[model samples]
Target chain A: MQSSYFTGVTTSNGVMQHDFTVGEVTGALWSSKRAECAPLVLMGHGGGNHKKSPAMLGRAQRLVVDGGFHVACIDAPGHGDRPRTAHDEQEIAALREALETGEPVGPIVVRYNAHLAERAVPEWRAALDFLQGVEWVGDEDPVGYFGLNMGTAIGVPLTAVEPRIKAAVFGLHWPEALAEYARQITVPIEYTLQWDDEHIPRESGLALFDAFASEEKTLHANSGGHKELPRFESDSAVRFFVRQLVRPSIPQPDLVW
Target chain B: MQSSYFTGVTTSNGVMQHDFTVGEVTGALWSSKRAECAPLVLMGHGGGNHKKSPAMLGRAQRLVVDGGFHVACIDAPGHGDRPRTAHDEQEIAALREALETGEPVGPIVVRYNAHLAERAVPEWRAALDFLQGVEWVGDEDPVGYFGLNMGTAIGVPLTAVEPRIKAAVFGLHWPEALAEYARQITVPIEYTLQWDDEHIPRESGLALFDAFASEEKTLHANSGGHKELPRFESDSAVRFFVRQLVRPSIPQPDLVW
Candidate 1:
């Protein structure tokens, strides 16, 4: 119900920014919305897009409106407001060269994703620290996390290693990665997949389901192609988040059909 | 793969006069495949078709080869094998009544599916009883079940109440009904949904996901329209069944890129 934007100035380590406002429930303590002792949802975007992607925005709105949660999405290193560094092109070229060599490239891709996840964790931690100081929200709410595609690559490892994130959701990403990370997580999780998504392939989703460790987990299959966000699924995601994060003490009305 | 066919006089229960055998796989038993189980998947024609639906045939073939499951497809109660109990004018009138009242109404359509599922369970039990008397697959092997479309409506509930069924897959049915019955299930399940499916609406698929309770559940999304199986998803279903029932002890292979 309430809205505003805050700019996170660049520090020596990285440039941080929170472009969205806290909702009516979380207020100034948006970042602390998840757990009283935990960090907020550290959202990351997919490739070739910034924090304001329509898909990301739709997902974020569902989390805020239906889940009653606060989110902090940042541009990954070398993405969004942060200017590209000299190594960016080299990093791209190196990836291309690896592909050109026609080697068994699975592990190489995994390692690259791991590096990206590791590099993004510090900024996420800093963002959490900044959220703790905000006046609107308290420090007690639990922190849950989610990301799309490449963002999931970052969020998965960070949530696995970071104790602050108690629950998470990974969308538009391979389920196999989640399966590998499932062993490392002690919290509840929601895994979503597109039935017709050609981009990621359905087998990856199955692999992820096989790997999940949590006793309480859900696999939501909706009708849509890759990158297509049907309204029905968006609504389901919100309810899933609310069920995972919102405390029973909070009286919330149904916001989605 | 072994194959055979059997034909005999119909029983009081209208047992099929013809019986056929498909190939078999060696592994642990699953739903309908118990050592004493002669579980059979029944294929249902979608609409405007008889027992010769190729789409239904494709589904049955997948179950046979990938799932190592048995199948029996018959026309709706009065549709193919059985004699027509009503006139064309009467059937059309009944259809019009159903359309007008927004309720299923017709002498030929008198909730036959529910009865079919109820009847099949005992038949399956008898088949299992017969199989136990034979020397082929041992009782320790897994017995499982599966179905498509209208057959899904019957098979799912039948599997839910039938204890011998270890695992089941349902393709192209109402999600809401599946959700209603999902609460009764205690075995692993695989559900497939097509994102751009032109036949069934998206809401129906979501309703099923909302209701499913299997802890080990997989949902496959594909890009094609209804009745057109996506190659990747179909392959995933085959692998899923093999993983769940055939090789429960073996580690699942990493998803092929």
Candidate 2:
């Protein structure tokens, strides 16, 4: 990962955001200055959002300061700063026309997903490969993973491939729909869902959670649309990462040390 | 259709929403007093929401008053007042449990959609069959159809088999996925799609529109969630239906009778 002495304010947790080029992907890195070597959490944002998006940045700040872990976020392919595909243009045009005239826009959306599916996982893996070699980053094991909707799509496969991602937070996948990839996920997972989601059908989101083979997993769901995750759920996620990375207090032996 | 001196406050447009049972289906009929013999438009609501839902009611009021068409709406099978299926119970339980515990709810969701696919069309046909025998509700030709989301699921097949429906306003279908039914719709169609819709993948929705055989079709796509359609789009539907149903006033020639 090529990190730059970039211009940006240090966050409350002493997390500094810097522009980065990991492998062929361009992204932002948020790392804490206080810790020379810290537990790291890699975040993937939802579809149509970028690494520095408010949600991504907020989580990065929390994890770095509160959880004592460096956090990294990258835009999904054709999203953020990445170049858009030809299909994306056609799809957007079709979509605009549909909105103007009230026609079906399903084909474009489905195609857009398909296009992203082909590249999302591969790109995430590349980002992971770069992070694994970083000195100040916890390159070894127990690195946490945080992804929502689109993040879930890319992160699920990443978890399956990378052994370092010890804990994860994500949801909104149809395990059955993408059986080959969804079934292979076995890391400790925390999946969030919206019960009354307009697009992500409630049942499908739940079903994706069941597809994970992890023995240690939990579902954090609330009542709302795709964007309306309750405030408390973020606390749940923070607690999860802290619990996962910060070893719990060990009972001192009665025999004494 | 069962006509009754229904007890309810009629809207400013004289649109009356009356409860009725068409064969085995229970639904509401929204008609205007000023245009009892005017063009009739049958309406269908999206998933989760029921007939006479605010969205449905508002549209009904608009069409009856501004466009001069009596509108009717019915709950899809296993929706609204219709009895919930056994599968719905399991799906709901699974969803609630999944939300609480982070389990997979995909299978149940997939099963639910499949179950509806089987019954949705047949029930819609039953409603249409009952409507065909009504004296006021045009048993002959030039009838109009309007549906969205689940409405599309039931209405698509209804449009295919019912020859009287001259035009339609609906969408949220994957034609290739449901080729048999989707391919059969030949009437002029106006399909609405939400660009950022989570549940209905954009491509599949577009593909569904493509599956129709209609030569005259328009796509009205918008940027928002599933429920967040722009206000002006309703005016677009009103225009389409009015253009289809209301004949243009002819210029009086000197020699004309």
Candidate 3:
């Protein structure tokens, strides 16, 4: 199994944040300072966003502090501290131009994010391998994935092949390159879609949600544009993780001790 | 300006239940014992269910105890304590035969429920008028309506004509006769749909959700058959009402006292 190299650790508001690296991947882990062991949740940051973006930190805080689970987020390729390649620069420029010119950014975003997913999926698997090896972040129970927008672009493929991830919260992406992967995912899913998304068509969001093969999937379609995804959804996702991870049938030896 | 005739009152588990009548319409109200006045939520029970069915009582318990709101439910015409007419009996027989013979019950249920809605809508208005007149159940803020199946049938039209309802939680019914009324309703809405419902087609549910003219609406589609709606949705609805009714801007004068 690949090993993660720990760099720094900090505690704030009762949550312990650990900075770690797996090969070239840069990530941060947040956990309750008091819990002995908890299920792990891997979150993928959006395009142009870092692992510790406010959205990621906020969700991680809830997962760690409220859910009593270890949460980790890795910066997507060409984002955050990672140096962007010439290809990344070119695609980003095109996307910016499309947005500035009032042209549809869907094609460019779908094409670019799909490329990033190809690279990030392996990094996520390796990170999980290293995270589960830690005594405090045991692999006895299944892990979960929560991501949206560009995060959803990468998470769909990651959750598809990652057997360790038993549940996921994913949405706000088109099905173009992701629906096939979504169909392969059979774990419980909580998906969010904006009813009046300016970029992604409503049908596209619904279609992607429909592609998921999970027997226990939920689609939460709110009446707003993409970025206006309500804050309450974050709380709902945390509760979902609690229900899926803290099952009464499973004996949590780690939690007991 | 009608007055409610109180028939009985009981308290259990920190909740107060009031049995009342407006003219011939019988109903029950639930509220927290300590709170002087809170927002009111009117619930419509499912077909073949009474005002205080298990679903109604359980939801009322949460709304009253957890949400700090008064909840009321009335017996639809020819339901609960009311006597069923010959027409009601014939329709009931048709629905029962369809269910027992493994035949489609949608047509019969839709036709019968629509008939009930016509009678139930005015009764609900009278109940609301009477309930609002009570000292403890103030009408300062807009009320909420929650119902599914037959409840949705009654609620769609009731909400259309009753401008006092600012929010509603509706689902588990076809659009058929309800879509026109749904379009007239511009209040915030939370709708639920079973992905694999046998009676209602997926498109039918989606279409009904689409018909709502509410600018702020949500569709929660879960992967389950018609009778398998997850219990957590009830909690979600309670939170939604809290967001709508207990707003920061709306000075809750009733709650202050």
Residue-level error in angstroms, candidate 3, position A215 = 0.8
* iRMSD values, candidates in order: 15.9, 27.4, 11.3
| Runs in model 1 lying further than 4 Å from the true structure | A1-40, A91-111, A175-179, A199-201, A223-225, A229-231, A248-257, B1-257
Compare the candidates by DockQ and give the number of the best one: 3
For the second chain, the TM-scores of the candidates in order are 0.63, 0.81, 0.95
Worst lDDT run of 10 residues, candidate 3 chain A, spans A248-257
lDDT digits (tens) for residues A64-156 of candidate 3 = 877888999888888987889999999999999998999999999999999999999998888888888777887786799999988899999
Chain B in candidate 3 has what TM-score?
Answer: 0.95
Instruction: List, for all models, the DockQ compared with the true complex.
Output: 0.04, 0.01, 0.35
Ranking according to lDDT, highest score first: 3, 2, 1
Model 1 has an lDDT value of 0.54
**Which segments of model 3 are wrong by more than 4 Å?**
A1-3, A248-257, B1-3, B248-257
Estimate candidate 2's alpha-carbon lDDT, on a 0 to 1 scale. 0.67
User: What tens digits encode model 2's per-residue C-alpha lDDT throughout A115-214?
Assistant: 6756877776677667666666646546888887667767777778877778888865545434466578766677777656666565676567656776
Highest lDDT: give the candidate number: 3
What is the TM-score of each predicted model, taking all chains together? 0.45, 0.46, 0.94
